[model samples]
Target chain A: MKNNFRNSKLLVIEDNSDHRFFIEKAMKTCLSEVSAIHMSTEQQAIAYMDSCLYQEWDLPTLILLDLYLPNRENGWRILEHIRQMPTPINQIPIVMLSYSNQRDDIAEAYQKGISSYLVKPTHEEEWVSYFQKLRSYWWETVTLPKMRFSF
Target chain B: MKNNFRNSKLLVIEDNSDHRFFIEKAMKTCLSEVSAIHMSTEQQAIAYMDSCLYQEWDLPTLILLDLYLPNRENGWRILEHIRQMPTPINQIPIVMLSYSNQRDDIAEAYQKGISSYLVKPTHEEEWVSYFQKLRSYWWETVTLPKMRFSF
Candidate 1:
């Protein structure tokens, strides 16, 4: 696959340290230019988003969120918070990266307006291919909303 | 990429005949087994979904919707109608395919709960690659929600 995702920012909210490291490594290896920001807790993620709004910072191109988090609100709550944001801020794509393949979780995520739901792969090779295909689809095939930052 | 999409159904609601043909052809070419059902009007799409509910028929794995349709309700209206459906049906992924790259359109589509927004490629090669990447991402990398048909 071609690398069309250069210079794109990806914000990931994952509680597990190993999963976070794997995702960051896979994304950086797969995309030509990727700035993957990690937040281990829901509070941190929300705080980061608030700071972005306050500073008028450019929002990440995509958000990789874990369904279950430790010591804070879960991914569903985060999804709701983002969706309630005004205008373009609410339009950013959010893909849920969780281990839960439960029917209720999948249904709820879609209903909550997730861009996509992906079950994390178990093996290392699978993760590599997963990130590769994801980058190809989002960067090459999809037309993301043009982010408008109010000056 | 693995052909995990065998026997999967895709409902396409597009007004333009040429675009429909291209999408169907591309999907068929990329996936090992794909049933691409085309609906030119919004009414037909609704009718199909209703039939699936009434007859306990297998719903499509993904819905390819056009933002602007020739007759009846547009894509946004259709999206709203689907999202209001009960349970699993509402969970079906809806991807908007449009020639319009307007910021308003993209933002509105995402806000209304589209899974992804894709700009229709102008060239044939681009369409082929687009479908290939989309199939790889959705069928291989992502775990789609299990459809529940109430008899």
Candidate 2:
């Protein structure tokens, strides 16, 4: 499984510290060689992407972004910030995270070019199971873009 | 599981007769309520999208497109065609299917705005496993856009 995800990376942009820690740990449980970069704010997330571009290091293969707004229209602003980037950076797959199951929210995310919409789980165990399913589907079944090292 | 995929739909665009049949069967094995629309040519695929728009029936939630060209340059033309469409239609997730594991192929697909790239498995059993993982990841974990009834 490690060989399958060779050169692959993940970027998680969430404001909540507990969620940021919980997500990173859950992902590690599913994939042994996990090393996810965490960004607590939208600004930090954007800066990380820019740093990747400027440093010549490869971008993360997947991005998990949390919806930030109190109202229904969450994640769009941050998604737009990332989408406004240049070239391949803008093309990276982003999975938008939210706490709602409303059709309108999913519809809006789809319209905004979000790769996938994920509802935050209620319990911690569900997070592990979620990452396991994600591991099998995304890491094993899917072919991701090539990654290059800075060195 | 049936309720999870309530109004969701799938479009499979593959030239090979066996693979098209195989993918549909494999998907059905995992998801009890499976109804996949198959198209043999790029034109047929495009027409289906147009028909969905004209009829006001929502488009498929996911699309599995085969890489046609013998060289690495495949699936881009069909991808471009779909992307040229307006609104949510163009933003629908399209997974590129191929038999190659080359990084270049995956990179190109990502660059072309493909949601994901999947390498077609060799054995028949692998196909079933692939669909099962797909079911778990896409159907259960991901919150797909709401589907509409034509009537």
Candidate 3:
């Protein structure tokens, strides 16, 4: 598949450092020219989004969010907040990447408006394959919303 | 990837007969055992959904929606109506597949809460590739919410 995500910027809100690193690395490998903004906490992510709104910064093409945060149930809250925002900001696709495979958690995330839910793989090889498939589908096949910088 | 979607059903809302056939064919080719329900208009889709609800029939795992419909601007309306429905029904992932690649259309669909927006490709080879990628990503890699029959 062609690198359709060469110029895309992605926002990843993952608390685990190792996971964040792997995701960033995988995304970079998947897309020739990609800029990924990583956030380890809910507050940081909110602050970044707020700043982007206030400063008219270009919004990320996609958001990869972790379900379980370090010390709070903030993933769902964050998703709800984004969905409640005005216009284009609310339109950004949020894909939940979590270890929880419980039906309740999956149902709850979809109910909260996650674009898709992916179960985090335990094996490193599985992670690689998962990200590769993700890159192929989302970046190559899906037509992501064009982020307009003008407000 | 294992056939996680063996017993799953898919709801396809498209006005064109050719598109519906192709989608159904592609999905069947991708998944070993998949039942796809096709509707040509918004009214039909709504009636089908209502019947499924009333009859306690199994809801679809995914919805492939067309942006333009016959005689009305019903795509967004249908999406909004589904989202307003009670819990599990509203949680069904709606993927918008349209020929229109307009930024406004894409942005509007996402704002209306479509899980993903894919531009309907004209070429047969492209459609095959798209459906293959879609099946791999959604059916195999992603965790779909379990459809609960009981309200």
Query: What's each prediction's TM-score?
Result: 0.92, 0.87, 0.92
In candidate 2, which residue ranges exceed 4 Å CA deviation?
A: A1-4, A69-74, B69-74
Please provide, for model 3 over A1-151, each residue's C-alpha lDDT reduced to its tens digit, 9 standing for 90 to 100: 4344645777889999888777866776665465788888888888877776765455777889998986337887788888887667888899999988888998999998999999898876677787788778778788887666632
Winning candidate number (TM-score): 3
* Candidate 3 regions with alpha-carbon error over 4 angstroms: A1-6, B1-3, B149-151
Which prediction has the highest DockQ against the true structure? 3
Model 2 / residue B56 / CA error / Å: 3.6
Better of 1 and 2 by TM-score: 1
Residue-by-residue lDDT tens digits, candidate 1, B26-139: 877886477778888878888888888765455888888998896224787788888888877888899998888777887788878888888888887777887877778888
Q: In terms of lDDT, which candidate is strongest? A: 3
Residue B87, candidate 3: Cα error in Å is: 1.2
lDDT of 2 by residue, B52-80 (tens): 77664557878888887433333577788
Q: Is the docking of candidate 3 incorrect, acceptable, medium or high quality?
A: high
- Tell me the whole-model lDDT of each prediction, alpha carbons only: 0.79, 0.74, 0.80
Model 2 per-residue lDDT at B92:
77
Q: After superposition, how far is residue B29 of candidate 3 from its true place, in Å?
A: 2.9
